[model samples]
Target chain A: MSQEIRKIEELARTIRRDIVEMVYLAKDGHPGPALSITDIVASLYGSLLRVNPSDPEWEGRDRFILSKGHACPAVYSALARRGFFSPELLPSLRALDSLLQGHPVMKKTPGIDMTSGSLGNGLSIGVGMALASGYTKKNFDVFVIMGDGELQEGIVWEGALSAFKYKLGRLIVFVDHNGWQSGASCNDVGGCVSVKSRFEAFGWHCQEIDGHDISAILQAVKNARAETNLPSVIIAETVKGKGVPFMENDNSWHKRVPSKEQYEEAMKILGGC
Target chain B: MSEYKGSREAFVAAMTDLADKDPRVVFVSADSLKAARATNFAEKYPDRYFEAGIAEQNAVAMAAGLAACGLKPYVVTYGGFITMRACEQLRTFCAYTDLDVTFGGLNGGMIGGEREGVTHQALEDIGIVRTIPGVKVFAPADAAETYALAKAAGSLKGPVYFRLGSGREPDVFSPGTEVELGKLRKVLDYGNDVLLLSSGFVLDRVLKAAELLKAGGIGASVVEVHSLKPLDADGVVRELERCQVAVTIEDHTVIGGLGSAIAELAAERCPCRIQRLGIQDVFPESGPANTLADKYGLSPQAIADTARALAAGKGR
Candidate 1:
């Protein structure tokens, strides 16, 4: 692997460690969802995104929205490590008065583009941001990450239709296709037949890639950015609880707190940054 | 009174005027642009206008996104759709985020959507929006008030919901009337034997009701409460304290609307005997707008009768 990819992989490992730690410390969070998107978050924050942590509200900065906001631990970790805020605040994941909220709140947290906790809302918000960029000639891209199960929401297709109608080239989305939702597997819950074909039918530029592959994730984003005439959706095939062996593809970890022994074992596997 | 005009027309004109002054002003429609009479805005500022194509949820969320990006967006559609269908988006995306987005909800009361029937009437919009924290709800009494409120909404910091009327609404306020946000506009102030608190297009009917009360030797004061969320609590309390009986008249349900707002305030501050003159917790049928309103107990005659009875201590 090249040195840059190695560095991003290392950052991704650290973010994974942070996600596990934050959820373990909070005693309450969606660990599986957070882990599923850790690499993607790391890939974006580590490289590609043109954002200044010091000036979080800079008009020229690219915007990022976490549509499946229960997965916020990953984002909170990435934002902190990206120097938007101190890394010390990572443990205060869902505490009252903490900047890191259970869901990503744009007003409370730096580097957050839109306040999103409700499913199927981020894409529409991204469309608006993309439209605003075209309107004001700001020339900033809007990135969004949604869950595979969130596709069942009717509003998601509405947003897809809007993005296509507007031809929002700067808006790129990543569907963390972990195959597992909170209740059961995505297929068991039904209606998520083919995410790629669905988005393609809506006239989006579509790509499918291994989400855990940092290089592949970056390449997909680059490919998305090249398509300046349409919105892009990278259906990243991710494992539900990635990085740790016992939690991998385990639906129980969707919201369960890690036991002390499990926590120690998970940390041993994740290792030091 | 000035020449009667449609609230939807006035709202579009105000928004178009705002677009002329502020480049960031944009309009998002959910396939209801023609209903909103916003073709002028769409024509003048083609780039700023967006259509979400029959998707109220997407339109609202998109507007929130635009507002987050420092652009003022107005999402115009049927009042029921904006308040009921996309209610969650308005609550979470706009109100929770405290975004500078305005919702122009057309056909705001029982008088609206007479041909389209019960499905289109927005009797519960005010109640739904009022409960959402940080959303300023304005049910303008007429076209003039709607214009002023729409313009004022542009300068306001957070989310606003304007409960507008159908094009057939009669003129209540004259042209160029300055509407202060969150303050009651006193229309008719006679001896305070009874206080008639009115909101939205029903103010005209309430005014007539006040006149009827006067003819029957019962002096009634009519106050137009345009802003329902940031209600003029102090002004309303002062009026309630003077009158022995207070009646709230609106084109919405008595529950969780203007009547409930007044009753909640009066119970805490003044403890006055009150009557809520509106649709009494029932769905209205499809008919002529005036006929539906009259059947639903929102007519001038019914309002006058209720106030007279309360003033004479007949119905305590």
Candidate 2:
């Protein structure tokens, strides 16, 4: 494996471990979706994104928004590990007055480009950020990560069409198609046959990849950045509870906390927190 | 009073002037440019202006997005569609995050779109937008106030919802009435028998109603409450204490708009007999602005009659 890819893979595993540990501590949070996007988020923060850890609000830095804000434990972990905040604060997840909220709030959390908890809002906010970059004659890219079921929101399609109409080459979105939504699977809920086809219809340059593959996530984002005319959407197919064997693809893990015993097993499988 | 001008026209003109001065100002419309009087703005600043094509939710979200990137975005659409249709987007992205985007709701109240039915009327918007935290809501009474409010909203640092009356409103303020935010403008302080505290274009009617009350030998005080939210409670209480009873006159629902706000304030601070003059609990059917205003007891004569009855009932 290339050095960068190997390092990103390691970081992804650590982040997955952080996700399991943080949720285990809080005894609440959406762990399934967070685990699913660990690799993609890891790759973005680890290699691709041009962000400064010291200066989280760097004007020239690229922006990333987790539109699926319930899955914020993963992002919080990524940000913490990337040195935006101390990893010690991870245990304070969901705590009152803690920086880490149930959902990502930009004002509270460092390195959060947009405050997003309500699904389908981030992409639209991302479009605004991208529009700002264009209007201000800046060259920073904006990446918005959304969930598969979130596409059901009419606002997502509205933002999708807008991004295209604006021809925001600087905007990139990734739909984590883990196929599982809260309490049910995405197919049973929204019945969206293919994310690739939906985004293609919306006039975005499309790519489908195994979300767990660090190399694939990096390569897809790299290819997306090369295109200068249209916005891109990488439909990353992933498992709901990716790393842990017991939780993997299990609908029950969508918002469930790992019990003490299950937590031990989960941490062991994730190579320890 | 100065010459009558459309509040919507004043809003569009102020926006156009703001965009001309500040390059950061961008106007985003939901295919209501003609209705919002933004055709000239769109033509002149084509690069800055964006048409969301009848998508209020999208336009609102996009405005939030545009505002997030350091540009001031003014979203224009009918009051009914913009506030009710894109309510969640405005709450979540704009108000929740506290982005500096101006939500310009044109045709406020039952004034405009007489033929378009109840869906187009904006009687419930003030109440709907009032419940949201960190959102500055205003209903400009005339063209001058609309222009001032628009300019203020553009310069303000947070989310603002400016309810613009339909075009063709008589001027209530003098030519250069300085529209300071969060301050009540007392249009007429004839007497403190009954204070007619009003907002939006209804202030013009309130002033006229006060005149009719004077002619009928019923003393009345008229206070124009242009700023709906962060409601100048001190100013309101100052006026309320001087009067035995206060009536809140607005072009919105009596539920959560200025009427409810004043009632709540009065109950807490200056407890007095409070009367709310607005649409009761039914959806009013569409008609001509004047016809609807008359039917709903929003006309000068009807308002004066209501005030006379209220004053007589209190044995003033």
Candidate 3:
């Protein structure tokens, strides 16, 4: 493995462990999507992102918006692991006193580019961020990760049109195509099987990549960074509950907390967890 | 008497002027540019303007996105449609996130297109909006006050709603005058006596009623309550406390507009005998603004009659 991939893989394992631990504590969280998105978030924060752990608000840092905000544990894991704050604060997730909320608060959570929980909102917010950057002549890029099912929202299309019209090359989006929503997949919801072609039709630089492959994920990010005229969408192919065998590809685990035994098994699967 | 402007046209003018001065000011319309009178804004700043074409949810969510990226977004649409149709995006994306976006609730009263249908009448917006936290709602009585409210909304520290009347109403301002948020414009104050409070397209009628009441020696005080959310609880108490009689008028339903707000305030702070005059019940059908105003008891003569009746009912 490349040193970069090795580091990212280790970080992803650690984040998966953290995800299992936190939800085991809270007894509530979207474990399936969180686990599915672990590698993506880990790779983004660990390898691809230009963020400062000490100063989350570094003016020149690339902005990130989790459009699929239900997978907040994934984000919180990445943020804590990257040292946005102490990793110990993970237990305080969604706690009354903790700044770390069930949904990311850009004001409270350092490095959270936007506060999002309501589905289909973060993409537009991300587009807004991209537009702001372009209008102000800021060079920083923006990344928005949305749920595959969230594409059903008309606002996503609105943001897509605006993004293309503005020619915001600095903007990139990743739709975590885990093939499930709160109820069904994008195909079952909207008959959209090919996210890459759909986004390309909407005037984006589109690509599909194995969301779990470290090298492929890294290359996709690299290709996205090289493009400079159109906003890009990387439809990451992923399995829900990617690490835990019993829950993988199952929608039931989309938000169900794991039992004590399940947590331990999950931890063991993500070795060096 | 304090000068007040009537109709949504004044709001369009203010947005146009701001769009001209600030390159960052963008007008995102759901094809109400004609009704919103934002054509000048579009003409003056084409690059900064957008048309969403009957897509209110998209328009609002896009506005939220634009606001997030540092673009001050003024979302223009009919009050009924914007509030009812695009409410989810407004509440979740804009109000909850506190996106820096201003809403122009055009054709605020039965005035949007009275004859068009009930859907365009926009009677329930005030009630629906009143429940939300941190949204500043204003029903401008005239054009000058609208520009003032729009300007204030642009510079506001948080989200704001600008309820506007349809154009073609007689201009209420005397060439130059403006109003501000959270501040009531005391039009005609008669000491510790009958107080007439009103808002939005109903202000002209209230002022006219004040004239008739003055002729009758009843001496009605006309207080224009343009801002409803940051309601003047103390000011309301000070003005209506122990007063034998007070009357409130609105073009909206009596449930949650300025009339209900005044009633709630008086009940909590200072108990007083107050009568609310607004749309009693049922959606208004298509008609001219004047005819609709008359039908709803929002006309000057109708309001004057209601005021006299309210005064008499209070045993004044």
Candidate 4:
């Protein structure tokens, strides 16, 4: 493997390690979403996004909102690794009075672009953020990380419809299509689960990618920025609990925090940490 | 004391003034331009005026979308529809995330469209929006005060709900009345016997209540609680402390409106005998605004009667 690809994989491993450690310490955090989107976030922040951790609110900085906020561990882990906050602070997740709550809070957490937990509402907020960037002529793109399960909310379509009406070209959405929700797979849950075609029909320039592939993720974002006429959706197919042997592809990790022993085992599986 | 200016004319007037300074101050509405007095503002500033048809929900969602793109958007429609029908959108995208939105709702009471019956009434809107944190709810009593509230709501840091009665509400305050969200304005000062507080479209009723009390040789202090959410605790407690009787009059309902807000404030801080005179808990019957106010015991006389009873230890 090339050095760049190897480095990307290493960063994803570290992010997953932090996710496991934090959830294990808190004894209660959704590891599935975090693990699933680790590579997607790493690719965005590490490679594609035009953001400054030092100047987090820079007028022209790219915006990212976690619409499926329950899976905040992935984004938070990425933010910590991106040097927005200390990686050491990751273990404080879910503690009382900790800045890191179970869900991402815009006011509370730096690098968190919007306060979200309400499923399907995050994209609406993201629509606003993207629109705001366009309105102010800030020239910064807005990114929304949504979940397939969260797509069931009627408000998402309401927002989706508005995004197209405004032709918010800078709006980029990455749907974590891990195929599982809190109940079961998204297909079992009612509503439009075909995120790729849904966006295309909504007039969004659409593409589907393997979410774990850093190179593919980078290419999708670059392609989105190049599109001048319409918004874009990268419906990334990801595996819930992606890396660790026990957690990978498991629905139980939706809100499961790894135990201390399990954490060690998972980290060791990534190779003797 | 400054005359009580209503919010309806006030909101448009403020928008007109803002349109002069800021080119991006856009007003999106669901076909109430003439009633909201936005006709002149629209003509004067056509670029800033956007009529969104008869869709309140779509209008709000569009405003949320506009706000996303950094446009300062003020959405106008009936209080009943804007807060009730599109409440989910308001809560999800606007209030929860603290978007920069100004919602100007008219017919705040049974003020306008009372002829249209229960569906058009905005009796519960103030109470409904008060529950959402971080959003300001302002009800300006008269025309001048309404304009002031509109300016503040427009330039406000976060989301705000500004209400005004429909049509020609009495200009309670003289011209140039100053108002702010979450601040209470005292109208007439009474010594220490009765305190009568009122909100939008009911300042005249409040004034009448005070005069009736004065005729009966009871001093009644009248206050305009324009800002409802961050309830003016200090003003309420101080009024309760000096008063033997308290009466809250509004053009809204018994549940979650102005009366309950004042009563809750009084009960928690300075407990006192209180009579909340407003709409009944049932859907209001179609009639003239004044007729319905009387039928629901919300007129000045009814408020006076209830207050006298509370003053005489007679209300249940």
Q: How well does chain A score by TM in each candidate?
A: 0.98, 0.98, 0.96, 0.95
* Higher-ranked by lDDT: 1 or 2: 1
Q: Which residue runs does candidate 4 get wrong by more than 4 Å?
A: A1-4, A191-193, B1-6, B22-73, B81-100, B112-116, B152-156, B179-183, B188-193, B212-219, B314-316
Question: What DockQ, between 0 and 1, does each candidate earn?
Answer: 0.88, 0.75, 0.50, 0.23
The residue-by-residue lDDT of candidate 3 on A1-273, one tens digit each, is 789999999998888888888888988888888988888899999988898998886766788888888889988989988989888899888899787888887768877877788788767667667766766576788998998888888778877887787787889898898889887665887785577767978889998999999888889888988988988889899998888798898888988888878888887887724
Candidate whose DockQ is highest: 1
Which lDDT tens digits does candidate 3 get at residues B163-225? 876665555655457665688788877544578888886677788888887777666788888
Q: What total of clashing residue pairs does each candidate reach? A: 0, 1, 7, 19
List the candidates' TM-scores in order. 0.98, 0.97, 0.92, 0.88
* C-alpha lDDT of residue A134 in model 2: 82
lDDT tens digits by residue: candidate 1, A179-199: 988799998996547999899
- For candidate 1, the per-residue lDDT at B67 reads 90
- Please state every model's RMSD to the true fold in angstroms: 1.6, 1.8, 2.9, 3.7
Candidate 4: give the TM-score of chain A: 0.95
lDDT of each: 0.90, 0.86, 0.79, 0.78
Could you say which candidate leads in TM-score?
1
Specify the highest-lDDT model's number. Answer: 1
* Total clashes in model 4, counting residue pairs 3 or more apart in sequence or in different chains: 19
- lDDT-sorted candidate list, best first: 1, 2, 3, 4
